[model samples]
Target: MATSTGRVTGTARDRAAGADGARGRGRPKKAGPVRRSMSQHWYAWAMVAPVVVVTAALIGWPLVRGVYLSLTDATEATMGRTIGVNVIPSTYGFTGLDNYVDILTSGLFWDKLIWTVVWTVACVGLHYGLGLGLALLLNRKMRLRSVYRLMLILPWAIPSFVAAFIWRYLYNSDYGVINAMLKAAGLGAVGWLDDPTTAKLAVIAVNVWVGVPFMMVAMLGGLQSIPGELYEAAEVDGATPWQRFRHITVPGLRIVSSTVVLLGTIWTFNMFPLIFLITGGGPGSSTEILVTYAYREAFTGIRNYSGSAAWGVIILLLLVVMALVYRRALRKQGEVW
Candidate 1:
């Protein structure tokens, strides 16, 4: 009996040891943090690699090349030779800030800069006013609301170049619809695109028309998002329409307004086609903005590629400053919220 009990006890101990040994062998080894992290994110990195490569090849390379070109004295005659593989006749050397200096010394730069600012502000302001007003009207219960919305959005749907062409015809001095209307009204004919002040105003008016529809749509969406209870409560408290708009509507639409205004400002600042197609920066460069001037410098006679690149850099710097300010303002608003 004692011998049998010893054998059973020894068998049980052997089984337990074997089980533990199996478990020890089955367990996985722990990896180092860096290797583990790379293993986890390898798929994501692979997915994004193509985009990164394309961006570097396209935008990054062009920007670097443009800066290099700006530092050199590259004109129409020398541009191909400077960048070409084969030897050429003319020699070009690095100007090293000369292009920027020339631009700063010219009075034309300041004038165009000032006009660009004015143009952007005027267009964005008018867009907000007209858009908000129309949004308010549309937000109310009214007849044919869908039809009105569709009609209002038509201007924005049209291509900017087409709209500019249409406006150019409208602003023509002779045989234009605007002049004909003035003649019928017994008022003197006005040179809409001929006079410098009027030309600036004309472009602004056209831009406002093209931009208002987008603002109206954005504001309308924002207005719809506001709870009806807030307005009802305000009215119950004897708040006037203007008071409600000022207090409730404006505050509710603040975020949307800021976003649209920033986008509008950028778009307006870069608006080249409308100004180029309509006035061609004419009337003695009266309506010329920085973008138009840069385009003219790059493409017109002499083709001052380096000068145009310098202008582009200045524009880029200005945009960067604006973006920084906008981001700071957004952070402040977020904190308030």
Candidate 2:
């Protein structure tokens, strides 16, 4: 009888403690759905208010304005004009989807888009491949590894525009370093920037030089993050170098590689400085990618403001679609970020 009474009292005390804990946590759940009033979640809304306002001002406003401009007939010459103290009304009229229709109907869009895709793929591929190789080498103990890393990363440390300008001089047809070196080796001086094919390759080389450092750094971080014990354990199991890498290193670096590859693709797709500065979309516009072509439309000769806006919107949509597709693919592979 005494044992039964003690057990009942202990159960009652446990229930009381749970009630106190729930009260300490602010509120308890109801049997059905519970509605939270503004007073209950005011702190959270307050914390989010700044970010919402900033987004609406910067990204939201520009995107909305660009979309609106793409829908209308805006041009640099006819859109709007202003005096010192007067605000001029915008003359651009809405034309629905005419701009998009024109762009889609034209062959130029598809052509430049194809070139852009090729450029993106080539540059990102070289970047990741060379970067991973160098990262793997540098991760091992070696003499002067730090010096080698510093030298390799120097190109990325320099400003991209400066590097582009330097490469342009190096590619000069007469008395350039590259041509001089070719002559020294008894090889005929080939025009690096004059020919369309060579110009495309030249730009890719410059971009790869500038891009690989970032990829190497990211991959190196991923390499270091994989525990040393994992490799040691693999060695103990008599796993070969290739087998251990396939099983452990690749899986461990997946997150880093995924992020860097995505970022590299996006950056390379929109890379303007190297192409614009080096090629100027020359040799009959043979090397012009989508971004450079849009640039030509916006700033060169008679500015097509609405058309350029349409191009911008198109590029934005394409990137969004690519990102969504990439994310879906990653999700399918069980990689969530």
Candidate 3:
């Protein structure tokens, strides 16, 4: 019986091997060319490729060209050609650091830089203070809350150029509403845009007014996301309103506050159209920010392309440094997660 069982097992194993060989012979040996049609995400790539190419052409080319043009004597008027000789000497050749040094050493540039810093700090500080205060007040359930929110956001919703233009008119010396109000109050009409100090202050005020709406909206969003239970816990701990705000609200909003501050700084630093359209960097260039200075260098003052490029490079470096600093500081505070 054992011999019979062994014979049967061997026969079954041989049959299995034979079946495997037969199956292998019946199937094709090679996988025919994959035959992958242009279907799965291939069409999406095809659609986006043109856009990617065009964007690269528009943005990348100009950035690369700007860097190259910075090194050469490229100007809008002249396409960077040597005036007399092909072999240019140091006097006529590429200035390695002169452009940068010129802007750096210029008293006007430093004065503008200092004013720019002061303007940015003041605007950002006021914007956050007023905006967050309003956000907190409006975050509570109140009558006409929606109306107030809409009214608050209207400043931001309006185009910045339009707002700037309106403010410019409002600050006009002769017929401005501001001057009229001052006269009505028995005070002398203030030349808001004529005097250097007044002009700078006026621009900063307009900036703060227009900028606070955005900060308010951002803070309102952040406030809504804070869990009410935290506030309840604070109340249970017998915390005062200020203490609750300091502990729960402020801590919850640290990340948002940092973001708003950084964005406000960048926007305030890059403020151009407002100052240009309103003051035109007049009143002795007191309100000229880096962007306005760069524009003047590029377009007005001898059309110094090298000077403009140097200014652009410096602004880029400053922004990069600020971004790095914010990242480092926020990360240390564990606010960047």
Candidate 4:
């Protein structure tokens, strides 16, 4: 029996070898290792190199040059050695802190800085209040709701320069929509842009109109994110509508609100188009914000390169401070949801 089993195993092995031999030496062997794509091997770098170089040329080079130029007395007419090129210390003299000192000492500079701060705060405040209010109203059930929202958001969706021009005409003392309405109500035409105070208010008003829709949409999204169960619970606890919003709605919107404040502050502080298009920082410079003033100083005024650089540094520092403040506030608020 053992001999028989051994013979059977040998026979099975021979049959398997015969089957393998019958397959005609198996299929032809596959080729060598797979080749990498051209992009995967080298072309990717070639493609991205241009973008990197362009970014460096546009952003990095200018930034570095500006900082370096800030340290020198290079002027519009003296930049390319038009005023005697030299490598000596006396030739390319360093200003050290004099430029900064001069800018800080100027009363107009401080006033412009203050105006920028006040304008940012006021516009941001009104934007927050009005936007939240409108968002809540629009979020409610109503007839023609979409139409109302569209009409309300039209001012913001329009290009700011275009809106500025439209408002400019609307604020005209003779035939402006505002003056016409006022006259219909027996009030005389108010010189919106001709008077200094009114001109500044007009700028703020236009900014508010242009900014509120974005703020409203942001808040509306936040508002809609609140679960209805919270409102149901508030109702069970006998909470009024105001109380429900105060606790539930406001707390739920902390993050979006913070973002709005941060963005609004930056945008308002840096706002230039409306002021430029509408007032041109006029009514005797009563509406000149820091950015416009910087533009004027750099391109219009005595073409002071160092002064403009100093102002740029100051504006950057102020923005940094504002950012830090926002971050600290965010930390204090923590995550609300």
Candidate 5:
């Protein structure tokens, strides 16, 4: 009986080995050269062709034209003007890097850039700090959470221009509620917009107010995604509140915080309307950011078409560099958005 069992097992093993040898010997046939059929590929391209056309016509053309103009000494008048049915042909000459050189050598650009950097940093810092604090408080199991959320989010819900106008009125040195309160408290009225320093702080505060709600909502969502078990376990292990927050909560929110910080930086950097509506880059251009300054170059006075284009291109390059550096830093820390 033992010899019979061994023979049967040997037969089964032989059969499996034979099957594997057969498969190994029969290699798959090599693929022939692929032939392209117009009919097959045309359909795929047709599906995406409209999007390509629209994008090229809208975005691509404008970008190309802006770059082209930036190299030339173009202005509204030189770009061709039609006066009383007689058309003046475009005769703007290309001047290579002259516009860029002139802009770089100027004192005005450096001053505006410094202020712009300060504005972006101050607003985004306050936005994230205040927003994360609020989000943490709201994440607790507290009553009237919805009510508090609505009240806090109202600033973001309102149109930005409208909010800017309202804040502008409130910051008015005369006939404003803020000043009225100051007077009631026996304090002198402050020129919030009239002074350079106060105007900077005032705009920064308005931007923070408008931006905090977005960061709070994003963080609150992140908080809810973290499992409760981790916090419970930490508490059981004798973890303090601060330890739990620093160890668990912060790591959980890092991805969300990084994303919001990048977005907030970009938005605050190019926030033209808020500054324009509030102080109009006033106090002799003390609060002028790059975007507002570029606007003045384009639309005000003689309408410096090429110079504005140069500034616009420079701003775009700066933003691209900032985004790349930020993403690389986050990637180093094992974070990506």
Candidate 6:
């Protein structure tokens, strides 16, 4: 009985080996390419998975929820019901494009939009000019250059809210140092925050002061990266300073300037702290930008959260359009290369 069992086991093993050899010789075993690829990249995917999950949880979910809320009639009264809290026992319903229509039809929205544009353009333009000018001046060999750069950078190093608070006092109507200085100069006290035009200008000036250091630092780095030989060659050719600057300096800094301007525009567009802290979007919303308007809608009286979310979507669309235009401009300039 034992001998018969051993023979049967040996025969089965030999048959299995013969079948495996036949399969290997027939057409070559197929490689599972997709499985192989996944195996190769499993480690990379593992490393990236956490970041992807976190971003989805933090940014993606909120964005999706905001869009949903915008489509619904989700005011302060209905928000609790929508969230399952049922604090006020209200019901919310889909409103489709009503929020957007209302915003578009409102004169206040147009006014804020115009001011937002003016604020962004003016602040970014001044920041670039002041920063580039300072960068060029500092790039020249000068005494106490390090000290001067440090002093210029101090404004950027300070917290923006703190800077806003300090500026608020300076712009005070009565005994503010700025008014005192004007009085000393035989000029009347200017209503910095009180008047509409002056309030807008005052906030812009404060933003410019806070933002210039960043631009200056960026421009300085770009200036340093420029090859000295180019300047030397221009000098040897008897090129005037203005000619050299127009031809060489501006062209050399094109990429840097574009990047700085793009970032500065976005920052200035979304700037909330300075205006909120100093002006409170007050004196009848004179200095209110889109961001401030959205905040007021979401958090202040009435709490029109869905309306605010709609505004946020509009802001996002505007930013997307700006980014696309910038990218197209860069491509046209061959800067992307």
| Each candidate's clash count | 0, 0, 0, 0, 0, 0
Which candidate order results from sorting by lDDT in descending order?
6, 5, 2, 1, 4, 3
Residue range 93-146, candidate 5, lDDT tens digits: 999999989988999889989999999999999999999999999999889999
lDDT of 3 by residue, 1-337 (tens): 9999999999999999999999999997663344343445577778999999999999888777565556655455554446666844333346577777777888877887888889889999999999999999999999999999999999888888998899999999999999999999999999999999899889988888899999999999999999999999889989999999999999988889998999998988998888998899988777888889889978984676766877887887888898899889888877754
Model 3: per-residue Cα lDDT at residue 141: 99
Per-residue alpha-carbon lDDT of model 2 for 1-337, expressed as tens digits? 9999999999999999999998879875454322354467778888999999998999999888889888988887776778899978877799999999999999999989988999999999999999999899999999998999899889889998999999999998897899999999999998999899999899999999999999998999999999999999999999999999999999999999999999999999999999999889877898898888888988988888888889999999999999999999999999999
Assess every candidate by TM-score.
0.84, 0.84, 0.81, 0.79, 0.85, 0.86
> Residue 81, candidate 4: how far off, in angstroms?
8.6
Tens digits of per-residue lDDT for model 6, 41-151: 999888999999999999999999999888888888776553465355657889999999999899988999999999999999999999999999999999999999999
Better TM-score candidate (2, 6): 6
Candidate 1 residue-wise lDDT, 1-337, digit = tens = 9999999999999999999999999999899998897799999888999999999999999999789888988888875464466766655679899999999999989989998999999899999999999999999999999999999999999999999999999999998899999999999899998898899889888999999999999999999999999999999999999999999998999888888888888999999999999999979898889999998989999998889999998898899899788879888878232
lDDT of 4 at 156: 83
Candidate 5 at residue 226, lDDT?
Answer: 95
Off by over 4 Å in 3: 1-54, 80-93
Clashes of 3: 0
Query: Model 5, which residues run further than 4 Å from truth?
Result: 1-53
Q: What's the ranking of the predictions by TM-score, best on top? A: 6, 5, 2, 1, 3, 4
Candidate 1 vs 6: which has more lDDT: 6
What global local distance difference test value does model 6 have? 0.92
When summed lDDT is taken over every stretch of 10 residues in candidate 3, the lowest stretch is: 31-40
lDDT of model 5, residue 268:
93
Give candidate 6 misplaced runs (Cα > 4 Å).
1-45, 81-90
**lDDT at 97, model 6:** 93
Worst 10 residues of 2 by lDDT: 29-38
